[model samples]
Target: MSLQDLHGLLSNLQRNPGIPLDLDWVDSIRVNRSAAERRAATLPARRTVKKKYQAAWLLRAIACMDLTTLGGDDTPGTVRRLCAKARRPVRQEVLAALGAEQLGVRVGAVCVYHQMVPTAVEALQGSGIPVAAVAAGFPHGLSPFAQRLDEIRSSVAAGATEIDIVITRAHVLTGDWRALYDEIAAFREACGEAHLKTILATGELGTLTNVGKASAVAMMAGADFIKTSTGKETENATLPVGLVMARQIREYLDRTGYKVGYKPAGGIRTAKQSLDWLILMKEELGNEWLLPDLFRLGASSLLTDIERQLEHHATGRYAATHHQPMP
Candidate 1:
């Protein structure tokens, strides 16, 4: 389906209303590292969509991206520019040449720090793209508990409709499942109507098993989405880690009948990598999981590369990266 068609489809699906904690289900989770690694190794070699179909898949990927700017140097001007890009992610000529100009294509959302939420909101007003703010002591998530919750509230008040909270990695490392659950649940309550995405920081969670367990706990504790990383970790959003999290989401849905979204952020900067992640979602969880509501690529430069590829498809030649600058 085209991005325009998918937009209407996503509008009708209800947001994930979280369920109560189920300790047994959480504890039963286990990750077979070798098997997961082997499966991830085969993704790139397997599914390869080409030509017009490839362009279609690329458009779908664009609609599922969270165009992001999380650096300490981010300013309102930068956030506004990012929002503008979010409004029209691809060049009009490229989209028109592909016969996709009428589709009104755009990225899934604009992710930024709390300070940039208002700017993003204002820039994206009437465009229907949500402003997602990374809160609750982002990156390390080591601040005091009260302050973290307060930060979420403040971001929401500032017009952020999505709150991406960082879970205390220590909770996962120490086997403090209850603490993690309570912390995430409280963050959910603070979110009010906004969606909550719990970042597991899979790289620092020690093992794939820990990543699986943490994913289950966060879902049980009412995380609307389970994110793979904060994009600041040394190793972030690997396919192996994404597979573990995706399986956990499938397991949670089977047990509770509540579908949780999955996001793999950090280091996903290429068009091929985007297609790989899309194939993972389709094969692992089915086509329904490929929508913006259930999947988002946390990226900035990824859009630039995707645009370059689409231009190549339209013109039969690749353009220089400088010609496709991101907002």
Candidate 2:
């Protein structure tokens, strides 16, 4: 992929409208655990990037990141601060040193809780940075079904262009594929023009095989993006889980001729880890998935580490972590 393309950032890609639920296809899904682990383990060692190319990759990672702030203590002030950070993820000196100051580098979106959607919207006004609200009871999808739909509608009405909805784990656990499909389809409908990102909470779903099946059901039900977790689970994003999800995305594209996005949230905290994910996208799904529209790293602190790395690349030494603080 050309490094020049990263400057354009977010794309006006077509949304995944979804296809009819294919129960047969869902049941046919299977993941080889050992193979996935082996592949993921070997991925990092296989490719190494340095100098200007590595800097370019890091910038691309920032562009695809969903700078997020989802916490009980989160206030509007905190939300506004987070929006400011999203608008200019890298420091001016760092971007200028890399000759990227004019690139207009920015995060893919700013994610927050339902109540903070408007606050983020107002802060990010006219910046073209989409505001993503986490709904459906957030980390837990146990709220009343109607209430979940209501939450989605309210956020969209408040100006959230994207809605990150969690799926009912019980539906996947009980092998109720139809229930999962119906749940996501309803969330998609409520989203309307707003994009729908379905969180599988893969860590709680039991096995990698279940991860594959859940991913298929989400895409079949019309999830514009299938996220790995809500970032609250004991086990958040992992390479094995991501590999399984990427494979599902590839299969979905081959079968239905539609493209579904993939996001690996939580536990992804370093610049090196970000490069690993970008390599995974380029190797498995090709270059298109590297863009913000198809890939997102749901992280809050990851940006700090990325900025520090960029600083290190620009100069020859590391700066104190406080220099790259987040709100």
Candidate 3:
């Protein structure tokens, strides 16, 4: 019985915040050191591309946004609320700039704070891209449950099909796993048909073990995807953190036959970085995990750089940054 205290654990995790979560007893579950090493060894090879350096599939893969304001000013000077849009507005610019050139097979998802959802939503209209918003108390999950639920509602209302939220660090650190779990589960319920990406804010967790624990807890807590950080956190997504999360996701799926999603957000601002993380997921979870439903990369300034690299390869000359700075 590896953590079969469903009734008891569920009681501790949360109530009818109208969310769905899982009873996670992963810590009590053992780790297979041999299996871990085996996975690590095989991951690097999958990262290598079969084709030459091309830049055609990256654009459609990127969900680019900064979360300026869910329903705030689409105007400049509102730095936190502007999302480089009032300044850059390159979400579509990059798409058009890429023109017919296919972006590499990397880019994933874009993220923004709760307040910025609508702006990102509006900017990305007709671009055939999914809009993600940092709903609930994102940078900090201090707001009340109702408030957080409303925040999710607002983002969805603003046209966000994907909702990214944060687990309250205070609760998780205090051994209050149940509270964090319940909160995440409830958020999922509030999300309705929308996709939910929950941020563990790993830098704040302070250990790979804690990161592993949080990742498992979030998946069980009904998170459609478990993410690394908010980008505002002290430690954003790193290789080791990604490794730990991937390992947990692998183990969970191995046990339950249900494959959850993993997202490596923050500090992913380049093509190589994005590709490396994708390698981590693919190697750990297999080719089926390569799609957007299972994995995503949340970056702000990466799409165009990949484009420049691709264009240089395509045209035999360096591409200008002005071509399109975002995807």
Best by lDDT: 2
How many clashes (backbone N, Cα, C below 3 Å) per candidate? 0, 0, 20
Question: Model 3 off-target regions past 4 Å?
Answer: 1-24, 29-47, 50-110
Q: Per-residue alpha-carbon lDDT of model 2 for 103-151, expressed as tens digits? A: 8888889999999999999999988889999999888999999999999
Candidate lDDT values, in order: 0.90, 0.91, 0.62
Give lDDT tens digits, candidate 1, residues 28-79: 8788899999999899887799999999999999999999999878888988
Worst 10 residues of 1 by lDDT: 4-13
Q: Quote each prediction's TM-score.
A: 0.97, 0.97, 0.74
Once fitted onto the true fold, the runs of candidate 1 whose alpha carbons sit more than 4 angstroms away are 8-12
Task: Give the distance in Å from residue 145's predicted Cα in candidate 2 to where it truly belongs.
Answer: 0.5
Model 2 worst lDDT run, 10 consecutive residues: 1-10
Q: What root-mean-square deviation over C-alphas does model 1 reach?
A: 1.3
Off by over 4 Å in 2: 1-11
